[model samples]
Target: MVRCYKCGRKMKYIRGLKFNQYAVDGWKCGDCGEVYYDADQAQRILLLNKLKKQKFRLKLNQVRSNLILRIPKEVGEAMGLRNGSEIEFSLKDDDKIIIST
Candidate 1:
């Protein structure tokens, strides 16, 4: 639990698209509107930001009835992606594909 340092009010939990790349969990102060992150959440966001800066070249392949996009071992490990893990993909207006875990 987090407390508002300025006004002594309880903080509320919230998540959203922040920093133009990832959605993070944080606390918002009810009385003073201050925002803060817990220790684990802060660490996760930092690693995610670093992973977002990495680029990988992959060859698309067909397997059975699906198209497979393979991620590099280092890149996947850095992003905490494992076999059979689920991911989200989005196509931006500029035709760039965004992948997130």
Candidate 2:
């Protein structure tokens, strides 16, 4: 059981709590509306915050008839992307392409 720091009340365990658009398990205080996350989930959110602040410039390489876009090492590590990892690609408007894992 977690206790709220501000109101000195028992916090309720909430599953799938949305934190910065990510689903995380945490405790919430009903009185003060305070939310708290465990260390592991907090670390994950911090990493995602760092990833959002970074920008990368990449080039496309052509092998045979396919073009390969290489992901930077730092970005790959932050996203936990591996060699065989599967990703989804989507086009926005007409000029921007979004890649999600």
Candidate 3:
């Protein structure tokens, strides 16, 4: 049971995206609309923010029947992604795209 610092209301437990990647348990105050994460979740959010701030330029290559988007070595290593790791692609809008593992 957590309390909202701003509105002094009881916080409700909710599951939300931790870093736009993983799901995490957090608290949200109904009255003030404030959100709070636990220690581990907060750390994950910080790491994710840092990762998101990093910029990587990649090139696309032509495969036999399809186009392949090359993932940089540094980015793959930092994200702990392997060569055969499974990933998901999402198109948010006309131009924006998101990829996750």
Candidate 4:
């Protein structure tokens, strides 16, 4: 069963494809419009997901098990995070985050 990469919904398998560089499959998400460029990536992710569903996965659910952040006190003050205020944590790309706290 094919699932949308972004939306966790069952997707209709339109076709298997071999693009200029990779093997892929076309799937349309009912809730979102994110098209996967490489189906191999999706399949790999789905395998892990299936393992989790089966209660057989035992992996850290993070990019890093122990992440570290060291910002100067002045910098934290400048960002108005010195008073225990909440801050937003946003993804910088696909692999990093910018926590403004």
TM-score for each prediction?
Answer: 0.50, 0.62, 0.49, 0.27
lDDT of each: 0.76, 0.88, 0.79, 0.56
Q: How would you encode candidate 2's per-residue C-alpha lDDT over 2-98 as one tens digit per residue? A: 9999999999999888877888889999999999977688677878799788787889999999999999887787678999999999999788999
Order candidates by lDDT, high to low. Answer: 2, 3, 1, 4
Better of 1 and 4 by lDDT: 1
Give the runs in model 3 whose Cα sits over 4 Å from its true position. 1-49
lDDT of 4 at 68: 41
Structure candidate 1, residue pairs in collision: none
Q: Which whole-number lDDT from 0 to 100 does residue 8 have in model 3?
A: 92
Write candidate 3's Cα lDDT for 10-67 as tens digits. Answer: 9998977354566778898988889887767766556666767888777889889898
Best by TM-score: 2
Per-residue lDDT of candidate 1, residues 1-101 (tens digit):
77888888889988762533566677888778788765565676676677668766789999999989988876776567888899999998796898878
Which candidate leads the pack in lDDT? 2
Pick the winner on TM-score between candidates 2 and 3. Answer: 2
Estimate the lDDT of model 1.
0.76
